[model samples]
Each structure stands twice: as C-alpha cells, then as structure tokens.
Target: MAWVKWDQILLPYDYGGLNVSSLKLKNYSLLTKWWWRFLTNDNALWVRVIKSIYGQSGGLGCNSPLPATKMKIFSGRNWSQIINIDQTPSKLGCNLSNVFVKDVGSGLDTSFWNDIWIGDLPLKDAYSRLFRLEVFKDATISDRITITFDSPVFSWAWESQPTWRTEDELASLTNIIKLHKFSNNSKASWTWKHNSNGAFTTDSLMQVLTSLTAAKLPPSSATDLSPFVPKKVGIFIWRAKKNRLPVRVKLDRKGLDLHSTRCPVCDDDIETLHHSLISCKFASNIWDKVRRWWKFNQLHLTNLSDIASCSNPKLVTTLGVSIWQAVVWVTSYYLWIHRNNCTFGKNIDSAAKIFSDIQGKCFEWINCRWRKGALDWLSWITNPCRFDSIFTKNGIG
Candidate 1:
C-alpha cells in the first residue's frame, strides 16, 4: 500500500497535492470550537457539563484533579526554573492559562483585567502595577463606563493612587484605552488567539504543535512549495526530494520488478532519484542550458538540497524568490517527465526542447498564479533577474 507523509498529504491543493484533511488536526480545531461554545453559549448542555467539571478558576487553572494536584505540588514554580528536561511541563497546558476575549456587541461578558481581550493581550500582564491597584479587578466590560459620543472617555475607578514607579504602566494603559473600539452587533465571546478569525483552525494548531515535538528535525531549506506551484508538480518535487519516487531501482530494492533498473535517459548507470533528476548526462545538459539562459553561471548543481538552498528568500531578492523557486521546481518536473517518457513511452523530448518547455511553464505559472504584478513573457525570457522591475514600473510591488 502507498502512503504519503502526513505533512505532504496535508499540503494545500495548489502545491501539486490533494486537499485531504487530517482528522487529528481537525479534532484539535474542534476542541477550540468546543471552548468557544462553552464560553459563549452559557446555557448549553455541553457548556453546563464542562462548567461542572472545570469550574470557574477565571483563566487561572482548570478544576481537573491532575492540574489541581500539579498546582499544589508545583505552585509558584517558574517554568524557566525547571532544569530537568523530563520534568518540564507541557506547553499545551499553558495555552489554557490565557483566555482571549472577543469583545463585540455589548462588551458585558468579558472581564477587563483578567481576560486577554485588548489586542489579544491581557491588561493585567501589560500593566501589572495598575492592575494590582485597580478597585475592581474582575470588572466586566460594561463596568467600564462609556461617556457620550461627543466626549468619549472611560471613567476608571482605582483602589489606590498611582505611585512614582507606576508612570510607565499608566502611559501604556492610556494608549490601550484609546484603541478599545468594539465590533458592533457581534456577540461577546472567547476565542483562541492563534487563529486570525477568533476561531480554531487545524492548520494553525498543527504549526504550533509541530514546533513543540520532542525529536528535533534536520534543518529544512525547502521553499514554501504549496499555493504557488501546481499540486502535481509540487508533489513530484516533494517525493523526488525525499528519495521516495517510484524509480525502477527503488522498486527493485522493495522486492518488486528485478529487471532493467538502468537510467532511462542516459542508459549509463542505475536510475535513482538523484541520477534521474540531477546527475544523469541528459538532466545535466538541461540544467546547464537553464543556468546559461537565466545568466546564473555560478549556480551549483548537485542534489535536491542545492536546489532547495537556492529557493531561500534570504539569498535573493524577496520579490523574485517565488518565481526563482518555481523555475527550479519546473526544471525538476520536466526532467522527471522526460525520464518517464523515455523509459515507458515510445518518444522523449531532447534536453534543449525540455529546457524550452520548462521556461514556458515557469512563465505560465508565475503569471497565472502570481497575485502581485502581471508578468510579461518577453520580459521574463529576456532577463528573469529583472523580474522585480516589472512590479516597480507598474507601482505594484
């Protein structure tokens, strides 16, 4: 049975792949949805069930026995102070400690100091001294009196006078208070701040969780391959880079067919992903012509890693990096297809012809998929290094 890597399978469709959804990631998103419902729909059955279990610690901690036990044992323990790797507390638990509020419509449901409503940050954390001196720490949004529209001002009632050391906190509070505008008609609710829409999303959750995995991964140089390149092309590049392509030699090693596992284009050596994509004489000829055409004479050609390194935006101008990465991808795609055609089909295109085709495909991909300035085919073919100039001429960059 063929199985795609979880990361590749979940890539966006435009990146030369299927638009399959990961249930695990979807379930994580649903957990946030449940939280949203539990916080906003106070009378719902599930909400009642949750409140019965978790109780109201006001974003301090849950009422679960495990957390309760951990809190009792590790109370006042700063996470940074824990030197033991095995005993380090999980970050997933920490995410629950901060509750972001969406103060829309009537802002009565949210607590001003305790909840992270303002700019997705807590007022207490931002203004600790002022928070400590506040008369009503748990004051609801409605408790902050709004004056007349002609003279809009918040009448804040503090428990103690501001001290000399609290000047910075007072300044920050003044700036934050001015920017507190409510979104009309929408209900006041709590949402995960990780998502832009104030809702949970699998993509965002996966990014966060993948970052926290215990095992460290090798540093990756691959560009943002999806959403720019076609899915078929992107998937092909991904498999080839991983050395998992269905080459005859690889199939033979896996106890499949045992005959004729030689290079299809060159007929010189064993046909592996590297030989077919880069090392073979046929592929090298195409790469040579492409380098000269692009005027990148000093560019190195060795493996998929080299190609990936070239795709780094930091190495080249940001405006042209996407198109440059696409060019490398399109070249790899053409080489693979040419090898397949020669191996399985009756006809195969020459290296020069394949290079020409790659150039055309690159132009089409950049123009069609590009959301920035419109690309000119003549300009691209003439000098791709000047691709950014087109955007400058049109005032579009």
Candidate 2:
C-alpha cells in the first residue's frame, strides 16, 4: 500500500529518463527506487514524500517510525551546524514518526494512539503537554513549518529557573586580629574612668584624647581657657535628665518670660523643651491655624523627642512630615525673631500675625521647591478665584 502511494507521489518528479519498468527492474525494487527518487528530487520532493507517507488524514502508517529513525540519524551528525533546522516541515514529519513510536512503546492504548496520530487531542491539552515535555518546549514555527530541537535540559536547569539569594555577591568573608604595646610618654589624654596615669584605656576616650592632643588644646598658650572652664556641669546634666516637661503647661503659666527660665507664651513653672515646643499657648494657636489651613487636625506633638525620633522623619520628599516640619521651623524662627524684636527693638507682633507669616512663608517655600504632583497643600491654600490662573501659569493643576 505504501509503495503504491510512493509511486503516485514520486513518478512525475523522476529525472533519470528511465521508464518505471526499467527503474523497478534495477537492483533496487520499487520502495528503494522511490526512496532514491525522493532524496535526489528538488526541495518540493520532501513535502510530497511526507504527504504520500502520512496522507491528508495526517495518520502515520504502522511503519512510519523507520523513516523517522533514518531522519534522526541524518540530523545527529551535523547537529550543531544546523540553525532553525527544526523549523522545517521535514523535521516535523520526522518528529511525528518519533512521537508515534514513543507513544506505542509507552503502552498507551491503541485508541489513544489513533486520536494523537490523527490530531484529535484537545488543542489546549495537546499544546500544554507538548510544552511541558522538554522535547517540544523550545519548538519554533516559521511560516507553515514547525521544528523541535533538543536543548540543554536538566544539567543547566539552575540558569533556566528563577531563584533568589540571601547574601550579596560582594561579601569579603574574612577575619583578622592583633595587639600592640602601650607607652606612658604618649601625649593622648584619658577619660577619667579609664585613666590610671592620665592615659586612655578605652578606644573612644583615646580617640578624643588623641584629637585634643593633635589640636594642641591642652594647657597651651595658643588655646583660650575662658571658653573651656565651666561652672554648672552637674546642674546642666540634672536639667537635661529631669527638668523637661510638656510645652502646653509652660505656655499657660503666670509671668512666664523667655529669659527667666520660663516659657514666654505660657508662665508655666519649670519650662522645658517639651513645654516650649507643643504646649506653649503661642505654639498651640500657630498649630491651630496651620491645621485649619491644611484642612487637618493639629498633630498632638507632645515633646521635641517625638519630632526627633519619628520613624518617618521629616524630609523634603515626605508630604505630611515636610509640611509639618516647615511649619514648626518657621514658627520657631518667627518666635525667636519676635523675642529679639521685643527685647531690643521694643516691638510686639500678635500670635495671629505670627501664624499668618508662617503660613505665607511655608507656602512660598513649598511652591518654589516642590514642583511635582498636586499636593493637598496647594489646593488648600491657593485662592479659589486665582487657582486656575496659578495652575495655568505654573503648567500644573
């Protein structure tokens, strides 16, 4: 049957000028003659030969694996020299025969084999399974041609697969230690706790002492001693550790003065860092106007430590913290300026005026420096009548 089909596909393309009878009468019989004809024919000959063997129904004959085996032997020799060889139709024809042999040898039922041979499998399932098998995962199709070539499958799987590493590639991973002798004549000063004969034992104290010696600041005629002498070291330490409290209480005290060790806005007793910042009556009023202008409630900032240690520290990049810090700094600067005005110039500005100045200055700074995004501060402060004009002028909305 196969010989009859091969004759029909190859008889018209023979170039030997010999009649079919003479060709058949040669040492090669019909099949061998047809095989010789198929190989020696033009490029179109392979397509016709494959069609004749497999037929329009796309079913490989029981003996189709033989040609596939021959093709595989031919492919293996110059394997590396072939580029896009798998994308040729002849390669696919060869693969079809190999697939059939694999399926039959694996003991798939005859019915299942018939379905696959005739291309009757569900399209999605066929494609997925073909992809899952490394054999067809990297197959490529060009025009009407389909090709499957073997890749470096399992050995280089690490390069093919995705993964993450815990440590950086740049780690040096080494260790070293050493010791050195000490000298009493060394000029290094000492921390009182580590000194035996006025030389430092700890690394930090030794560093400080060495720096002081290098600067020539120890008992030297060139160094000024007036600034170095101190009367209230213990008192300053006690004030730093124990005297601080919230700003609001200090703001509400009687007769509070900036120079009298009390909050000027509030005459609270024992005025401290926290009391001077958030709790002062002047600060509270300023924060209130700021919150209203920004359409946010005043942040309950209790102490300077809260401002300093906030996890999301204030930066020009931060929207809310940046705005808040701007307000705080401007308000502090204005209050100090007002204090100077009161003491030296004998001029006083109302808290409302101070708050207004802070808002105006903050908006000016933000508008000048922050050039991206439509932040809430912009809309909240810009006059409604001039909002569109400002946006158009600045090329922003």
Candidate 3:
C-alpha cells in the first residue's frame, strides 16, 4: 500500500496520480547511483578517494591502481553500504543490482561471475553449483579474459576438480563464456538496464522496485484509467479497485479500533470501500444525479468494480467515452473527499453541492486539456454523451 502511494506520487500529475516520492525509496534509489559511479567512474576524484581508503572493496568496486597500505572498509565509511547493495536487505524487494547490469569493456572493473556482466542473473546465481566449487569469488572480468595480439584468451580458477552436477554447471558456464565478446579497448562500466541510454534515473529505479513488490499483491483490474480525469481521481479509482482505500471497514479489519466502522456520512452501513464510494445513502443519491446528468441508466451498483466500469460502451462513441469517464471519475473522487469531510468534522457539502462541484471541475479540465473536444457549458452539463464528430480516444478535439 505504501509502495502504491509512492508510485502514484511519483507519477506525473497529468498522468492522473499524485506527486512526491516515498522518502525511503527515494533515498535508496539515489544511493544506487553512487554504486553505479563507483563501478564505472574509476578516474573520477571522489571514486578515487574512496578506493584509497577501502583497498579494493571486492568485485565491481573501484579498480584504481593501488596507493599502497589501504585498509579494509570500517564503520563510519558511508559508501560501504552502497558497494554491498547485492548483499543488503532491501526494503523494496530486490536490491539495486537487480535493476543495474555490468557493461563489460576491458572487464577490469566487473566481476567475472558475481556481477551481472553476461546474462540476466549473476553467474553466482545462475550457476550456483559451479560458484560453490570456485575458490576465488572476487575474480574480476579482466582477470578471466586476457588479450594476446588480435585474439583474446580466457582462464578460470577452481578449488578442486569438477565431477557430476558441478561438472554440468561448469559445462554450461564454459559454453556461455565461449560466446562472450571481450575487448581491451573500452573501459568496463555499469549501466541501468531499464533505461534506453543506459543511465540511471530515480523514477526508473522506483518503477522497477514498485513492479517487483506489486507482483506479491492480488492482481488489479483498474487498467486504462482515462487521461481525461484528474490524477487524484485516477489514483482514487486505482486504490478503490485494489481494496487499498483507507475506508473505516478496511482499517478496522486490519485491527484499527475505530469508534464505529459505520458509514461516516449516513452511518447506515460499515464503511467498506464499496459502501463509502458507491452505496452509501449520500453516495447513492449523488451517483443517481450523475447518471441522470450523463443520460446513463441507473444500475444499482453492488461493488466498486461496477461503479468504476459504469460507463456504457454501446451508448457512447470515442469522444463520449472519454467525457463520460471523466464525469464518473470526478463524481467518485468528490464523494470520497466529502466522506473525509464528514469524518473529520470539516464542512461537508450537500449531495447537490458536491455533484455541482464535480460537474464544474470535469468541464474545466476536459475543455482545457482537450481543445478539439471542447464543450459548451450548457451542453456539457445537459449531456456530455451527445458527440457526433471529432471522436478520438485521447480526448483531443
């Protein structure tokens, strides 16, 4: 749930979600860049300074020429954590190495087996049996590949003779290395695999971390939320569908000892996400008026999915679908906002007033963003579904 909040926050506002990032994820994402820099930017002065103290901090660490008498990393050294991201327990599921990969050039700065220089997973992970039998875990790519005139030579280190399953893993690993192209011309570097330019961005890393965690949750069906609606409205719809909305019933179910989980507005039913957003006496009346305004049939919605999918495809063309979706989403967002007002003792507008506000905001945003789809205020309020031309799905006129 927290990850989802951060995801929405990081989304561009016009994409119909919130702004800002979860500070923890943001910090971790930023820290990963230091690891990237240390792995690739060997000549940079800051990287050099760290190498002078940390004394070759193992595979994929700075490979600068030794300054002599360097000590192992000790406490109070801030970069130690970033250098060991692969071994760290990440709050965002997998660690930094999962999103980043090694781009071997001279291969001096990349781990031959531990770093993800060759395949999707590190050789240590993909060939764990062979990795277990290996003596040197910190062998760099340059240590394994050597250049002799025009051709390259490859070598390996083994603790003991291989046999059986270990032999099989060694066979597969050998086959992979045989196909790897090595050159001594370019410097080895690390790259963020997710981006086109092979560079790091906070947003790109956050997206990967979010995706890895999202898979553990139940799948959501709220895809294709309309671009016509406000970001808050899109985020609200997404959360509601995923059952992550902070309605009283859900909070109480999660062991929040509320005074009552009853509907915050009407106090007629437990304020489950569905009831709070759709079936509450207040929300139901608002929905009825909104349906009437859009010339939609008043179907009795029993679930959040029903309300979210209320716009009829058979009745509306492309242009009308966008407008209708915006109206429905705006209506839902205000209903939730009004519910919060009631719960917090804020000024709760009447159902009519809330509905009016929803209409006004929808018209303002839709017309402003969709120049080709602009509507007269009278016709927009009267019925937004009456479209005969300029029917593009993106809401552009």
Candidate 4:
C-alpha cells in the first residue's frame, strides 16, 4: 500500500495523480542526453569535458586529433561509467541495462551485435545462436561495410558454418535487415527506449518507470475522473482507492501511541479508511442524501474502493454509470473534507452543508467538461438523472 501511495505520488499531473519525480529515472533521462551530445553537438562544453576526463579524442580546446571514427569515441567509454565529482553517485539512479540505442539512419555508430538497432531488440539478441558463432562480436558498422566510390555496400562476416537451425535464424535475420536500407549520408544515433521517437522526455520516462513497477501494485479500476472532477478531488479519491490516506486506525496499527482510533463524526468505531469514507454515520448520511438525488437506492457502496469502481454493465449506456461514479467520487471527497474540518479545523460543518458543497462543486466542475446542455443549480438538483442525457454511448456531446 505504501508502494501504491508512492506510485500515486509519482504519477503524471494529466492523470489526476500526484507529481513526484524519481531522481533515478530523471538521472537516466539526463544521461540519455550524453548520447545525444556525443552524436549531435560535439562542440558542447560538457561533451568536451567528458571526452577529456575519459581520455577520448576530439573536444573544444584539445590539441589531440579527432578519433578515426565516431565508433572509436563510443568504444572509448563504457556506457556504465562511474564519475564521482563533488558528489557521490546516488543509489536512486537507474541501471544502464535499461538504456539502449535506436538507429535513426546509417547504423554506422552503433555496435552491430550489441545495440538495439533492429526492432525493440538487437540483431544479436534476435539471433543469439548466430551471435555466438560470430568471429568479430565487437565489430562496429564501419568495420563490416565495403565502401565503394559510388555507394557503400553492406555485408556480414561470421566465423562458423550454419547448421539447419542456424540457417533458419540467418534467413530470418536477412529478411529483417533487408527491410531497412541504410544511407551513406545519414548518421546513426542513439535514442531512449521509453519514447517512440527515441528522444528523452520527462513524461515518457515517468511512464516507463510507472509501467515497470505496475505489476507489483494492485491495478486501479477507477473510472476516468480527470475530465469532470477537480484535481484535489481526484487525488483524494485516488488516495482513498489505494487505502493510503492516514486514518487513525492505520496510525494505531503502526504502533503509534494514539489515545483512540474512534471516528470523529460517529465516535463508534475505529476511524478506518472504509468507515470514514463510506460506512461512518456522517458519511452514510451524506451518501443517503446523494443516493436519493441520483436515485441509486439499490447501489451498495461499502467503501471508497467501491465508489472508485462503480461500473454497471447492465445499463443501456455508459454515461449514467460514468456520471454516477463521478458523483460518488465527489460526495466521498467532500465528506472527507468535512471530517478533516471537524477534526483538525475545529469546526463542524453540517451534513446538509457538506452535501451542498458536493452539489455546488460537482456542478461547477462537471459543467467545465460537460457541454451537451446548459447546467444550472436548479436543473442539477431537480433533474439529476438528466446529467447522463448530456452524454451518449459514444461520449459526451
């Protein structure tokens, strides 16, 4: 659950999730610029500094001649070089194994066997048996090419004769390579694996990290609340869904010295995430009022997670279900705010007032996204069901 909270915090702003940056992923993103600088901007001061430190040729003020080829510069430094200047390396930094190259053009600078130039994998990886039998495993693109005055011809040099299995793999490799024709004028470049264009963007990097850790966390079944709800409400609902908001019961379970874990509103039982958000006396009253308005008396909402995942497939259209889910999220959010105001702000807002807050907020927020019909407080209260009328099976008008 703690991990889920962390993931929630790390999610991007557009997703209605918290904005927490992972330094490890950020460092990895920044390091991608290293390849970018090496290929594109050799005159960059940082590139020159790096080249000088690693004892590579070609820099701004260097008397030494440029390396025979770009491959020499690539071969000079290991991708996982550890350079500690004034500060030590952070344990948070992402591993080098996660990084790979994407060939943009000639594939000249990339290692033929090692780099991920073909598809989302390397030729060596796709044909491991052929890779093992290769005589020149570390050979670069320039080494294998036959340069004529007219145009460069491509060829491969392997060590051993192919068996039946190896022949099939070689044929497959030949077919794949035949699809990508190299140009003499084009230079091969490296790109981050996280993005489609092979460029490094923060959003893409965060998404990559989020996806990598997604399997360990419980999947969120919540509907798309970002289009209708406020960001604060969305975040509150997200926290509620994850069961990560700091309720007194959780504090007590953590061995914290608490006088009591009773709900501030009801004072009947432990102030658990479920009770405070759904089943508490105050929360239940609020939900009852909302249910009466929405006419969902049959719907059973036992916890915030239930509200988060309110989808009725039996309905003729998704608009009603989506609107109802948003209402549930909004109601639960205000109930929480009311509880906090009572406990921490030392002011008890009535259930009527809290429900009113929900109504006002939902109307204001949803109006921003809902465009099918004119929405006023009168129409909202009297014709709550009609909110779904503004939308259809396709989507909102």
Candidate 5:
C-alpha cells in the first residue's frame, strides 16, 4: 500500500489507473488528462515541475516565481537553513535539490560528473529536472546517494562541466614565469648587454666615465682628455701650411745656433718652430684682425694652446678646429710662397689681404658644402629681416 502511494507520487498525472485512496475517486482519467494539459500547456518546463511536486502544498497560490538568493555557507554550518528560508515546499524543493546535487557532483564522484555534465549548471539542472517529481523529492531527503546517479542525472539534462589543465602544460608555463623573474632582477645589466653586445667599446662609455669623475671636481680644473685625433694625418699636415712652405734648411746631424735661424715673418728674433707658429709679431697682427672679425676682444695669445682653447662664439667649434688646421698649413705655405716671390721678384699679397682671403674662402666652403641643406644655407647667409620675411611668406610663421 505504501509502495502504491509512492508510485502514485512518482507517476506522471496521465499514466496511472490503480486506486490507492479507496475513495472510489470518480473522473480520475478526466482529471489526469486535464492535469497534463494544464502542466505542459504554456509555462516553462521547470514551472510545470514545480507545480507537479508541490501543487497541493499551497505552492500554486504564489503568483510570483520564487525569489532566488545565493549565500555561501561555511564548511561546518547547517547548510539547509543557511541556503533556503521559505516554509513553502516549491521553493524548498528547488533550493535543496540544486544545492545537494551540486555538492554530490563536486564532492564525491568528481570524475563521473565531470565526464557527463555538458551544459550550464549541469549538476543543478540534473537534480532539479532529470528525475520524476516524486523520486527527485525523495532524493532530496535521502542521506546516502552516489555520484554515478547524479552524473547521469546531470549529463542526461546536458550541462557544461569545468575543464582541468594537464600537468605538462602547467610545467611549460614556468619558463615564462622564470623569464619575467630574470627581467625584474637584472634589468639594467641586461639592457646594457643587449646594446653593447656585452662589451663597453664605444666613445659614449668614456663620456659617461668623464661625467662621473667631473662631478667631484671644480669646473675650471676639470678637463676631458679623450683623444679626438683623426685617422688621416695628411689633412692636418696640409692645413698646417697656407699655400706651400719652402724647405729652406733641412735638419742634418748638425745643431744650429739660436742666432742663425731668423724669423721668416719679422727679421727681429730667432725663428724656431714655436716662435714662427705662435710668438711672431707679424702673426699677432693677423690673429688680432681674425679675432676682431669673430667679435672677440683682443687677448694676448702667445701659444697654439691659447688659440685651441679660445671660446669665441663666432667660431663654430667644428669649423674652429678645421680653421685652426687650415691656418697652420697656410702660414707655412705662405712663408714658402713669400720666399719664392722675394727671390724671383713676383707680386705677393700683403699679410692683411691674405687673412681676408682666408676668411672669404672659409665662408664659401661653409655655405656651399658644409651646411646641411639649401634652407640652412639661406638662413646662414641672409640678414635677419630678410630671413624672417621669407619664413612668413612661406607659411612657416
């Protein structure tokens, strides 16, 4: 009799003819037919299940769908009251079955449920809908249930399971983690290694060392001694002479007296290399005119070092070096030319005219070859007013 009642609860409303109530229930077939028609007619399938399970427990009276609430219960707490609160059977059944089936699949038979569930919320879907209403309700009350039944229940309803990564793939991930770790620890050294091929062989390294050492010294006493010597010595030799200096006295195994060598520029003093290059009175006048053209006040310059270190603004540093070499070459060249001119009775330009000619040639070379582009040449040559007008007319304003 109890089994019959259980079967009555398990069976769909349309399938049964056995009378367990013994009340001689009339219109049973008609009622069953109508029940099926009502349950499956227009509502979502879960609503139909809810109606069937708890229809007699005032469940049908609630107009609204049950309010769903989620709460995470700690391991040791009573899960039933923590997760579900309604005294209503419909809400109670849904909440309980959902929680229990999820727990069973996740807790006991993980592999079984993992293989089967293939859609969203598969474990919850299986427990909620796979069984007949009576069996589902009974399972909610059951204390011992295997994950095998749960897997099939969830799988038959088609729910997605969580994916697990393989151990080998996880092992491969450690290489990237190690690379990031190395980057954080050795960033500066690694950057330098990449830039210099693990060797500091460039001029910039010397510059860096100079800057570090210079920081500890007074500005006036600090000097950068890194050599700027060019590979071609001929360029330096050519620029040392003005036109071409004559070889008058070749130095043999004989040492000449100071009085024997007379100044080529002025016959006043002994003409050693240093006196001819730097200390001559005639060369001083030429240098004074050149300095005036460059807008520096006349300072007594008695040596090559003074010319090398002079900070005249008009002499562009690079051009200054080139000009210095040119001056040295031209002076020797002019001295040779002057001697030949004097011996053969040929016309020679004065020292002032020669200096002016050097300046003109230097300007011509700068404008034509050394300047970067036509615009730069124009800017270099044009007056300020004309240059500004050209820029404004060209829409570069």
Candidate 6:
C-alpha cells in the first residue's frame, strides 16, 4: 500500500523525497524538445512535411492554431495535442510555453505578436488592447518591419481607429519594440529558456519542472542528507523519518493481519519505526556503542530526533562530524538487518560483533571516499577523528 502521496514522492531529495523521476514530466519535456526542433530547424525533411500538411501559417505550435478542418481531422495525433499543450492539462500544472523563447534575426520566421520574442510575455499578452485592433494576427517580424533610408520602419494594419486606451498601448508597444536590436543578416531562432546556449536537454528541463512542481514540506520532515553512506541506507533513513517503515504497528494499521504489534526483537513494546530503530532495547545498545565510539557525552537518545544532535560539532571538527554521521547511519542499517534476522529466526550476531563489523565497514568506506588518506584501521577503530594528526593537534581529539 502507498503511504505518501505520489506527487510528494515525485519531489527532489531536498523536498522530502527520493528524487524519483516522473515519467510523465520526462515525456512532456521530450515532446517539448521535439516542438523546439520542429520550429528551429525549418530545413529538416519532417519539418517541411509537417508544414505542408498543417498549413504554413504556423507550424504546429508557432503562432496561429491549426485550421478548423485540420484541427478536427488530425486532432487525434500527438502533434495536435503538443501544439495546444497548456497549463490546464499538464501533470504538474506548469505551462510548458513559459520555457519557450523566440529570438528575432531577419524576422522572416518569428511571429511579431504571437511569439515571446520581446519583454516578459508575448506581445499579444503584454499589449492585449493593441492586439485587439490588429488586422493580421499571424504577421511575422519581416511583415511588420520595413527597411528604408538605411533605417527600420514600423507599420501596422489596424482593424479600424483605436480607442484612447488602445492608442496609449500602441505607443508603449512601439517604444518597447524600438529598444530591441534585430539583425537582417540572420534567420529567426528558437531557444529553451531553461538551458544555456539556447539548446534543449532532458536533464535541464527535468530540473526546471521539479522546481515548478515540487511542494515545500515542513523542515522536521525534510533534511539535506549527507552522501557518506550508500543510497539504500539513506532511503531507509528517509522512510524511517516519515514513519513508513512497515513495522508491526504500521502493518497492523494498514489492515495487515499480523499476529502481534509488539517488536519481534525484544517483545517489550509496540513496534513503530521509532521504537524499532531508536528506543528498543537491542537498538539502544547499538546506539550507546556508537555514541561512545564517536566520543560524545553520555546523552541518552530516547527520540529519533536526538540522533542528529549526537554528533556534536564542538566535540569534533566538520570533517569528523561527517565521519560520525556515516557511522551512525551504517549502524542503523545493520541494526535493522539484525532485527530482520531475529524476526525470521536466523542466527544473530552479538552486539560486540555488530559494532566491530560497522567499524570495519566505516573504515573501508571513509578511507576510500574521503581523500585525506590519513586513516588506518588502528586509528579508525580507536579514534577515527584523529585524521592526519592535524585534527588531534587542533585539540578536537
């Protein structure tokens, strides 16, 4: 059974999720890139074929919508759906067109009023009053600009005389257009605003989509996790933080017919994620060993919230705190594994053996992933913090 909302699970790590990629969002990004290709690469054979079939006024998603006849005849195709891709039908409710930008050059290709080539929005949106008075809505940049006397001139074919409000909008729009410098030598180009170099990339687009759709969770539930341990361990901790770890009580709550809700390890209390990993008798013994190994004061960790504070920054340097975090999480991983073994009636390692095993595991991981190269088995087991002897010299030892 699903414990968290699918939308919440789709968020990136910083937003209380595993950063699982959304296939719908990914497919949308890919289709949007294809739309970019169709508009920018006018010489491609497929683009030429599409332009011929869809009518050249606007290719698919460029300016004007497809003609009413074609809209109904081929409306079932993916291309038709892509052209009208707006925020309303989107998975994350993000407007894909917001990332689409138009760069004007010779202006033969770009639509003057329909495309977002200038200002914060499309000219049709920014100057809607003036747009209502235009006779040709799909006119290109070249259609509106006339070069005479070595200077560019503006021309507009209005439906009729404009109201006072429409005249003011026309003047404002004209002044904004004058400030934009256009080149007569180059062709108009389309750009993905989410990326550099005006190119489209799935990775860049996914990040943009994540930012738009990701919901902010409470700070207590979300945290910036460390990369010291493997992802599986991190995922376990994340699930534990959310209290979704399939413990006996949680399973019973989910309508599973378990024999009992008591923790199988000690059979002392109801098994919740916190009780299974933090305050249980067997788990508490492992935590105490880890606490002393890290040289923290004798502070009891009755709550899972106390685990993070166990690695006191004042007791160890920043580097030492990172190493300590790895030890804490690795211990948590093995403790859960031992609990499973006990539940299944398998032989279990003693507490000392578990501690020794984690020491070796942490030593191998830290020595390889960390670049200091100052750690040895002897130093790690005794005091892993005394890195390069400089850490001890600083009196953090």
Best by TM-score: 6
Alpha carbon lDDT of residue 309, candidate 1? 41
Weakest ten-residue segment in model 4 by summed lDDT: 82-91
3 or 4: which has the higher TM-score? 3
lDDT of 5 at 66: 30
Name model 3 segments beyond 4 Å from true. 1-22, 43-49, 57-73, 84-179, 184-207, 216-218, 221-229, 244-248, 251-271, 280-283, 297-300, 334-361, 388-397
Q: Rate the local accuracy (lDDT) of all candidates.
A: 0.62, 0.36, 0.69, 0.64, 0.34, 0.72
Give the Cα error of residue 338 in candidate 3, in Å. 5.3
List model 4 lDDT by residue over 41-103, tens digit each: 556886677666544323211112244475365544644232221022123333333354445
**CA lDDT of 317 in candidate 3?**
57
Alpha carbon deviation, residue 109, candidate 2 (Å):
86
The local distance difference test score of model 3 is 0.69
List model 6 lDDT by residue over 262-358, tens digit each.
9888899988878877888988888888778757676455666555444464444666677667777788788888889987889889999988899
TM-scores vs. true structure, each candidate = 0.53, 0.30, 0.65, 0.62, 0.29, 0.77
Model 3 Cα shift for residue 87 (angstroms): 4.4
- Residues 1-397, model 2: lDDT tens digits: 0112222212211221111222321221222223323222324655465545443222232223235655555444332112112222132232212222111121112222122322334212443332232233222111112112311111111223322221121011000001111222212211222235432223323233233323432121121111111212212222222333323234445434445655555565444555555666766776677656645534545655444322233232334454454555555456555544543556678888887777666666556655563334555364312333334334322
The local distance difference test score of model 4 is 0.64
User: What's the distance in Å from true for residue 338, model 6?
Assistant: 3.1
Clashes of each: 5, 9, 4, 0, 16, 0
- Which 10 successive residues of model 6 have the least lDDT summed? 388-397
What clash pairs does model 3 have? 16-231, 17-231, 372-397, 373-397
Q: What is the C-alpha RMSD of each candidate to the true structure, in Å?
A: 12.1, 36.9, 6.3, 8.2, 36.7, 4.5
Top model by lDDT, which number?
A: 6
